[model samples]
Target: MTIIEQYGWNTVWKDKWNGKYREHEGRDLLPGRIIGDFGSKFRVITETGETWGELAGRLRHTMTDSGEYPSVGDWVLLAVQDGGEHAVIHGVLPRSSVISRKAAGNTRDEQIVASNVDTLFLVSALNDDFNVRRMERYLIMAWNSGANPVILLTKADLCQDAELKIAEMERAAPGVPVHAVSALLGDGREALLPYIRSGQTVALTGSSGCGKSTMVNWLSGRMLQLTQDVREGDSRGRHTTTHRELFVLPEGGIIVDTPGMRELQLWEDEGGLDLAFGDISSLAAGCRYSDCSHEREEGCAVLQAVAEGVLEEKRLLNYRKTQRELLYQSSKEVKQKRKSAAAAVKAGSSRSRNSGWRKEMDEY
Candidate 1:
């Protein structure tokens, strides 16, 4: 099959993207897919396999400061320009799915991790860097993205014991499948082969030094990129992959490689929290109070489990922490939107009043 056939974008291109989209009275343009990026520039591949394009200044002006810009795997429209070296992106097509996070630190903007992803591989190393709490954070984001989440427990060779580590992760993740693989030795790597089938799209993401790039190289059967061992002092790896990129596996599957992130901030995914702490949710449901906070509430089933030793305190603490973080983030986003809406209303009212005065002056 051709690129369109393999990517399943042919029909999408025909029905939704073939012509200009004039939603609410806007003009139209030709369509393309954002395949990669280079600082402030984009590389969009059209449905026809022609690649390398950039966004026009006019299109950039139309973009609201907050809406997600074109990310890898996003379908976009372009006005084919004069240069054989370039084309201008006019607009971004509707996205089916996107995995995102608030850009690390105090930035109030959401960063797109990847778009239109079929599966999310949450890679975690088996070394000292592995943290169950961190895995929980990844799971919540994956659940919110509407993509299936698969846990990849990498670097089996580094760990002294594999079974114990796997069991701990499984306990935290509950129903999720956890696979242990050693990129260095290739042990247990076969378990992940079935997922690399032709036509499927997967993305690799996790903390720095989790062997995500190594796994990518292993899958491609060549040294597609460089790899670095974790620092001996802290056991954290340096950021090797600088940007998000879509790579077609020689075997069959498509995978998006992402830069290692020490920080994966959560954005607006309430359901993700529910799915991540499902056990906690189930327990909290039986609380006498309909709106129980699960903190110091009398006759709380969640607390009862903790008292009975069925639930670990650390698990409950992590659940509460994640819930609070999401809640805070949601509240912050709401406030920002409210302030923006008020400003927009004020601006629109001013524009309307100005237009009325201008009409009167013209009549006189």
Candidate 2:
């Protein structure tokens, strides 16, 4: 197979690259895929082979945020140097799909986990790390990213009631495939093979101790990532995979493995919440008010469903919590935009006043 084909490249991406080709004009550049990121620099795989690439100075100066930089699974335009061992990234093609999460801690920044993914495996262990609420959050992110989500419930060997856990996850994530697997025992791996076909890209993401690396190793049929044991008391494991890296599975597809996130604060839901909690959103449509808060309000279909035992109360509560978060974030973004616009207006006004004052002085 050709290099681009091996790296999950196709005509759609080729069209995007063609658009960039026109923008670059006559530059001696080639298309490369980013497989690994090293802080300010990245490791790109071009048709020629693998190479370490750094962002061009102009690209760095113009980037308004980290998202503008090349990430794992990103296809970029680059200038190969030193016999193709090193390169300079000039541009990033439009992403087909991107998986992101709010940067950890108090910051409102969005951290790009992976880009250009076709499928997202929202892996969660059947052990203590499994939380239906967290899975719901991941489903929201998966839906928002525009990739198909398949919930992977790992460590079936450890869970006595693996089927029960899978059923519970199915409830939390409606209409999405939920598979139970034991990477150690090599069970249920075949169910995932259909998603990991040639010319497609898949991403594995979840919290620590969820056996993400183990899944990677099993699927790849090699020890591509290191694994650590989880604490017996809490089942929390250290961040075995510190950085996001893309690997070519011998089986015929590409996979991006990311570090376990401690918290996945949402950046934007973009109708992801509605899809993630479609049951709640569908019921919400029957509310008396168009903007019903669904909080102890009369004629609230959502609350009525909860009361009637049709919908789980905890699920509705979590849906409300996520909705409020998205609302607050949206408001904050709008406020920021307004503030920036006001500042620009004030600055323009000040400049105009100065210009008038200078004209008057010159006239005098």
Candidate 3:
């Protein structure tokens, strides 16, 4: 058993990944989390913060093999540098949960928000930053990541009354915990610390100006980073936190904080849509046909609910919109994946043929 298994990192990622664990074990490779990442380099922290470092060539080469690139919350195989603070990251283990979004500005592929997380603290400042639809998008992505989702409404003091907002959040996120907190006021912050226990990993994601950095500073008992206030013209805050980073909570456990996302688009997780639009699903099951479209159909239970005030029509529309978006993304990703696979196979065959020709010429 590896030290990660002993320390519980292996247990968290065992079922989610299958990699060269036994080969990479021992003094060379240790388990570490990607805390701070720029474009090419990343800052990693293991149980011993002293061993923190960056990735090696092999891991970088293999990153294109799948969607297992290192993110802030990733548990990676680290090759310790014998004499310096820098260590070489050899490989990335599997992730039990991964939160992602369609990278902004018409990117074909998705961007991994965080990985290997146990809990997703979906932060939303209660001031002008709150939006039910936007919250739903994050909630869907969180649920799709396979982590337990909890809503953290920060800047609660800024809102005139939080009860109504909390109520709305509860409605928007059914069966999910909704807590309004103020990092400045120190109110309702304690309620969330239980989940930040030792050995587990919690990831925080929300728009900029949501006080994620402030929350991290408060949780860690020191200033981890800086923060800024929202503008007077708009309730939306400025981008104080720029990158996604991991931090060790002073109380226990680990936390990953991300820069605010002004534009969060859906990716390929449909289970999230099913869970988020559960009311629509439940209503649809009662539809007369097995494959009911729930639109203008006479026996559509969903339409009936919309007419009878049981379900909001807008809610159903959003569900369909998200579902269609998911389908479209999945289809597009599959086509791209097939194209990549075909290209890889063709390249490999060409390389093999070239090597054989070279061998024949050498024998001459």
lDDT of each: 0.81, 0.88, 0.78
Collision pairs in model 2: none
Question: What lDDT is reached at residue 154 by model 3?
Answer: 87
- Tens digits of per-residue lDDT, candidate 1, 1-364, equal 7665455465655687544463313434556667676657777665456667766676564563747578888777766655435677767777777898889878788888888887899999888888998999999999998778899988888788889989989888889889998877878767777777876778889999888899889888878768987888878999989988777787678788889988889998859888888898898889999888888989899999999998888999998898888889999999999998999999999999999999999999
TM-score of each: 0.92, 0.93, 0.90
* Cα lDDT tens digits for candidate 3, 1-364: 3433323365536544445463463554556767676767887766566455666676675784566678877777776675547778777776677888887887676788888788899888887788887888888998888999999998888889899999988877789999988877788867987788777788888887777888888888788878777786777777777788877676667788788878788877858987877778888899999888787777999999989988877778777777788889888889988998999999999999999999999999
lDDT of 2 by residue, 296-317 (tens): 7899999889889999989988
Q: Which prediction has the highest TM-score against the true structure?
A: 2
Best by lDDT: 2
Model 2, poorest ten-residue lDDT window?
A: 18-27
For candidate 3, the TM-score is 0.90
Better of 2 and 3 by TM-score: 2
TM-score of 1: 0.92
Report the CA-based lDDT of candidate 2 relative to the real structure. 0.88
